[model samples]
Target: MKQISFKNKFGYMMGDVANGLTFGMSAGFLLAFYTDALGITAAAAGTLFLIARLWDAINDPMMGVLTDKMFRKRALKHKNQKVDKFKIYLLKGSWPVIVAAILMFFAPDGLNGTQKLIWAYATYIVWGMTYTFVNIPYGSLAAVMTQDPVERSSLAVARGIGGLIGNILPRLIVPLVLVQFTDELSKGYLIAMILFGVIGLVSYIISYYTVEENIVHQVSDVESTDKDGFVKSIGVLVKNRPFVAVSIASIAMLLGMMVNSAMAVYYFKDNLNALQLMSITGLTGLLPMLILAPIMSKVVKKFGVKRTVATSSLISSIIYGALFLLPSNAILYISVSFMAAIFMTIPHMLVWGMVSDCIDYNQYLCGKRQEGVIYGCYSFVRKMGQAFAGFFAGVGLSLIGYVPNAIQTSQVLWGIKFLTIGLPAFGMFIAFIAYQFIWNLTPEKQKEVVKSINM
Candidate 1:
């Protein structure tokens, strides 16, 4: 077996960091940008999200088919070849996704109504499609790199460390820039988003060049059995127990995080009257990710993935719930919440790699390798979860007597409090339940599965 090096691991980690930059910023800021910055009503934003996501579900499977076909064609052309097919296709085709990511964040001025919605729909949907294009293959690259469980665990830690920097640093600093750059929040957010979009494009390109795929699994070159094979792919994935569990868990986690992101912005600006504290509080939340991520391999080895996630989720839930009952001092809230975030960051840093582990387990059980379908389904669930966050947050704000661009009311402040604190705590509880009871893949079982897959 070839030894895993810092160069190879860091290269793969770069792609993950780029992934975090694109998706994390989108999730963190898009709804706020739409409502507060782009002059869209919260209800309309929710409706837009519901409609666009309903339409966008088609993109995920289409991407899976597209990636699979590309892989198949590469194999055919390079038949009996020593070179890895996925790596070549990745190097050649990753640019479209990067371009699409940049375009998605480019919201020009001097547009109204239909034009604005059109821009949002076209850019956002295309970005989602492009994200699927890169992610399916990028995720598959993990298993391709190495079969050793220890090394894969190490890789997971390294990738998380890189991701912590990519994800946490921007979010922590962007708010400070926005607070300083423009008197209007929207204009500030717009500039910050564009900057992030450009950064995302650059990082994605760098990652594409730096990373290489090392292993290729051989599928039987039989005649195509069904023209409608994508449906079959979905069916195969549904039957995968580990896939289903991890998918549910990921959905819950993403939904909670998105709601928190939107609410955190609201809470800082509206409730606390400490908008600039957003930058400080964001830094506090991110601290654990930066410091603890490199050591995640040892943590997971000692505690195991399930215990690690479950413990973190539970601790976060309790703290989030208690935040509702605590005194609303900015310093006090920030202090306690940061400690909670330290524990909470573990799952954020490490869970996708756990999903990768689940994919390996599924392959071991089913006697088939379907990373594209499994990962595609996983992304579909995550996007759906994001959609729910947008929808719920809009409705939650509406119920809380929140009227945009209006003066403060005690009731409206209460509503913001509920959404920011109560909703996410509930979501964390749901995640805890899913992972603690639903996920049965322990480290020992994962080792057994890896052994079987290699055998």
Candidate 2:
């Protein structure tokens, strides 16, 4: 096996920078933007999210199959030269991603509710599709980069660090700036997304140029054109116990996190009556991840990713549950939120590594490596979780009688509290149960699988 250089890892890490800038922003703020800025009703915004992401169920897997077929053909065409199958999409899709990110926030100022809603649907769907085009390939690239479990974990850590920087910095900065322009929040979001989009584009270009895919590693055991057909490929994935377990855990974790993120602005602004505290809270939340990034790989190596994730989820659930009991003190709230954030980072850091492991396990069982399709299916479940979270946040708020920019009643406040803390805590508990009981990819099993593949 070849050693992956720091430069290769850095290049791979930068892809997540682009991911954090575009997809992270969408996850963090798109729903809020729809309701609060674009003047779309919460129910409508949630429905839009549901429709778009549900579409990803078909769209993501198809892109996976398409990319897999295209990569096989391209590699065969240029057999002698080093070919990075995924980078082509990264390069081609980068600008469209940025454009879509910008456009998703650009509802016309004079449009009525119906016009704005229509525009929202058009732009959001485009953004989701373009995001799929880029992200599925980018994610699958890690499995093919190298077959080392430790190296894959390291790559995931680097990606996690990149995501933290890309995601947290904007969370801290954009809100502070936007709070000043509360009356013109749509314009504020437009400006912020444009700036972030440019940053994301540049990051993608850097990743495209610096990253190298190992064609030999990709084709070591399987033929370049050894596709199992789409339906069978998906069947193989679904029947893989480890993949299914991880997919379910991912859905639970993301659904909780998305709902928490979607409802956070409200939690800080309305519940605490301190809009600026969002930045402070966000900054506090980021601290644990930064502190843990250096030691994350070592921890995973010792306990295994599944155990680490389960432990983290359990701890996070406890912390989230504690929030309901604590008095509404800003200092205490920030302190507890920081602790919860730290625990939450564990799963985020390990998830891609786990996904890569599932890809490996799939190859071990099925004798074919379909990185694109496997990742696409994984991404589809993740997007489904996001859609469900968005829908829950939207309709849940409506059910609770949440009124944007107005003084929220006690019922609405209680609902926000439940969505932010209770809902995610419940999600963490579910994830904990899934990983602890269902996922069985032990460290010994991982080594066995990898060694078998190489032999």
lDDT tens digits, residues 288-348, model 1? 7667866777888788888988888888889888988886667877887787677677776
Put down candidate 2 lDDT per residue, 348-412, tens digits, no spaces. 88788889889989889887878888998999888889889989999998999999879999889
Q: What TM-score does candidate 2 reach?
A: 0.96
Off by over 4 Å in 1: 83-109, 181-187, 219-228
lDDT of model 2, residue 100: 91
- If scored against the real structure, what TM-score would every candidate get? 0.90, 0.96
Pairs with steric clashes in candidate 1: none
Candidates in order have lDDT scores of 0.70, 0.84
What CA root-mean-square deviation does each model show from the true structure? 2.7, 1.7
- Deviation from truth (RMSD, Å), model 1: 2.7
Cα misplacement distance, residue 197 of candidate 1 (Å): 3.1
The candidate that wins on lDDT is 2
What is the lDDT, from 0 to 100, of the residue 347 in candidate 2? Answer: 87
